[model samples]
Target: MNTETFINQNWHDANQQYLSAALAVVRGALESYTTSLPHPPELTAQAAARQQAVQQAAAAMPAPSALENLCRLFELSGFERDLLLLCAGMELNGDFARLCAIAQGDAQKAYPTLSLALAALAYPHWDAIAPNAALRRWRLIQVGEAHTLTLSPLRLDERILHYLVGIQYLDERLAGIIEPVPQLGELVPSHAALAQKVTAVWNQTKTTTLPIVQLCGNESSSKRAIASQICQIQKMHLWVMPAQVIPLLPSELDNLIRLWTRETILSKSALIIDCDELDINDAARLNAIAHFIERTNGYIFINSRERMRLPQRLLVSFDIQQPTAKEQSAVWQAALSDIAPQLNGQVKILVEQFNLSPATIHAACAEAAGQLAQSQNNNLTDILWDACRIQARPRLDELAQWIEPVANWEDLVLPETQKQILRDIAAHVRQRSTVYNTWGFAGKSARGLGISALFAGASGTGKTLAAEVLANQLRLDLYRIDLSSVVSKYIGETEKNLRRVFDAAEQGGVILLFDEADALFGKRSEVKDARDRYANIEVSYLLQRMESYPGLALLTTNLKSAIDTAFLRRIRFVVQFPFPDAAQRAEIWRRIFPPNTPIADLDVVKLARLNVAGGNIRNIALNAAFLAADAGEAVQMKHVLRAAQTEYSKLEKPLTEAEIGNWS
Candidate 1:
């Protein structure tokens, strides 16, 4: 039999033996009391024989019973232990009620009570009924309503009763707020090392007081798995509670801490306070968590993305990184054991693209396997790739605007030199892993490994479209960050917002396009006041994050001169998108209309003479098409002239005869 089954069986046998002995003692007490009118020798002899049989059976047991363990763990005295058994007997044995009534000489007081335990059982003490007694302190046995402590109806806690019977489960009252964490089967090397550290620390600490462990990481699943693995090593169950659930009021916090600490000791369990989703800036919530950590005891862990400060207690923090690329490749191969040979070289690409944790990798593979089974011709690599993207998509969507890349290189009308630069950026991104890891460049220097670019040009010069083109070419998601929204007015808030953006985007390695970059990356002013100093700090912070970011960060600015020169020097590429000359404008006009649009006798040469940018030309073509649709006619030179006039009017520029000359 398995060890668990064997141990449980032994416990069961011992519990039965102990219960039999206790029942014999109760029978002896009842019979002796019933024949109290006169000294009956026969009944007295029977009582003495039963008492001796009970003591001999107790001594003859192979091991201490679960009841004995419970009493020892909770430090319950003989009186308190018997009181607990008396309450348990009411539930386990129906005849115990009659025995109790006979012992008490009152039918109404048939149920177990403090008064009856003191009157009938051996070694009964008044202190056992006190508020701080083992019976009341740990809530082992609950007392029901009565005029006094002695008269109150006594009953065993459902959880403790089950424990004595060798049944293990969480208490019903705690079921809603806390959940048992499943032990992890396998861990990545980094996480396994972390788990080992946690185990070592826990073992080295004195049993009376253990330091609170803080698991700091961005991946919640990995943190939880590590915590669970550590608990497994210590032969303890794991439970998780969201940090947000910690009570704010002092009284409620105290009660919760006390109850959880007691439960931890009683059940040999550890707690993981999950603060991954909590807003750490909230003072009240932080205070509540601090209070809980200060007051609680036993094995506890706080899971958060960043380290938390707890002044009242000693804490040890473990920084958990996502599985390394090599580890991830191994995980992918293991997860795809059936198809690993088929995907001989594609596994590396998946690992490079998505920085998924081991658990996520396994889950994604399982999901992909299901999809693969549904269709014979479906590509397993594609399904897995899409699943990884989907897993990494949700967290970042809330922080930035997800732009679907519908525009390819052809859609972006830039200079040939600029186009080549964009391609080089894409190439750098595609081969970064090979160059850094395989070529040993990463070992040389860790700084500026991230691909950052500056798209400096006038407004509407295809900067954003260039980003979309790169995203399409790389097959990666693109997010457009509004600098105004990210750059907070308050101190340090800007860095916090940027940290969130970068951290969320780390997994997918998605391309980040910071639009209107000049708003946040303006030239640093002389430090004349606190505001100017903070502005410089914000700029420096952005530069640091961009340099260290694992993915590409594209910054677009309409005014190139407004950006700091120091910032420009750090960028790997600066693609200047100049205004479209007359020839380029004509080309834009030629391809501006979709094939489906009806057209008639459009003068492209004359339209190009308007001296507008490509964006304005496209706008004129669209306006002319709408005008033709309303007039029920194909777009002609006349419609183009009218739209150009309206566009120039909006810009407050004169519709000069030299520009639109001979259009009609």
Candidate 2:
């Protein structure tokens, strides 16, 4: 027979033996009560034989009997074991109630009670009925309302009853609060190594107390996968509970911990407290979770984005990051085994561009396969790239604005030198892995390896457009972060916000355009107070993250001198976007209007006389087009002059004839 079939048969036989022993005990108790005397010699012999039969059957089984395992796990006595069996029989067998009625001498008292067990069963102890006893403490058996402990009706817990019948499942009471973690199929090497370390720790600590494992990392899914793998290796079921949902009240928290501990013992389970969604500022919830972890005695894991401090208990922390580039390449190869040969060269590009986990890589491959199956003409590489973007889109969408990159090189009006610098930035990003990994630059050191640039100039000098152009050139997503929104007056809040942005963008390698950076990245000031010290700390933290970020992080500031000197030294490239001269302004005007727009005779030389940057010229051009459309005429010099007056008014500057003279 197969292993499953053999196990099922053995389980069946063990239950029958246990049932036989329970029935024998019930028969002996009933006979003694009916005869109003001690048990007969033959009846006593049969009870002894039944007990011996159960022991033999348990010893012969391939695995330990569920009933026996429960008893041993809970450290139950003989009387307590028999009482549990009696309660279970009442639910599993039809004749148990009749036997109980005969034993109690009253048909109305059909359910088994403590008084009946004491009078009928051998080696019974009154202390078993205490509140701290195995049955009452673990909630294995429920005692009904009664005036006396002896007369209280006993019923088996539903979960325990099902377990006794070889039907294992989670307790109904815990189902709402906890969920079973599914086992991962194939683990990356790094994750597999983590699982092995966790298993070793658990085994080494089996004799002693197991420390609460703290999985500190930014990737929640990877941590969970490792936790599940570790539990599987240790032959334990993994259940997840969100830390935020933990009760704040002492009584409720105590009850929850006790219940979970009991369930752990009964079901060979471990709990993974997911604190990724937990708010660290909420002290009450954190305290409640800490208390729960401190009091519970079982295998436990705390999943948090950062390492949390719990002074009450010992913790073993593991930092789990995403798979390395080589490992990710392996994942891509394994996932797309069929198409690897056709697209061999692009795998490295995919891995370098999108630092995806194994699970995400597999999912992206599957998505591509599905699309390919639908349309055979679809480009597999493009589909995979788009799928990777979709996977990384949601988290980034929540923290910043995703700007669709529509501006190209021709659309940008920067000088050739600045344009070349932008192109070089893309080249460095594209070839980083080749130089750092394939070559030996990374082996030497990792300092200042990140590709960061600064676009410093006046507003409307094409800083934003340049960012979009680079994003389009590299075929990567661009996210615009307004530093005003990210900077906070509250201490430590700014770092928290910045960490979220970087972590979310790490996987996809999205280009980050931090606009108006001077608001946050100003020169450090003297330590006048606590605010000054923390402000400097925030700036230091930003510089560190920028130097270490794997993707391209671009910062734009209107005032270049406001940036700290140390930060300026760390930047790889600082491109100065100067105000457009008359020549550049004239070129911007020539290309500002689309071919579709109707135009009357307009003199570019006069329009170029207006002293404005590229951004204002485009604005004036669009407003002039709108004006001409309303006036039922093509855009002429008059419309352009009128629009210039409106623009100058909005800028709070006087409309001078020196710039716009002779335009009409």
* Candidate number of the best lDDT: 2
- Note each model's CA RMSD in angstroms: 3.2, 3.0
Cα lDDT of candidate 2 equals 0.85
Model 1 spans with C-alpha error above 4 angstroms: 1-7, 27-63, 97-110, 375-381, 596-603, 606-664
Candidate 2, which segments miss by more than 4 Å at Cα?
A: 20-24, 27-31, 34-62, 98-109, 146-151, 375-378, 593-610, 618-649, 656-664
| Residue lDDT tens for model 1, 39-85 | 58887787787778767766766677777778788898877877887
Weakest ten-residue segment in model 2 by summed lDDT: 25-34
User: What value does the lDDT take at residue 202 in candidate 2?
Assistant: 80
Instruction: Go through the candidates in order and give the clash count of each.
Output: 0, 0
Candidate 1: residue pairs that collide: none
In TM-score terms, which candidate is top? 2
List TM-scores for all candidates, in order. Answer: 0.90, 0.91
Q: How high is the lDDT of residue 343 in model 1?
A: 76
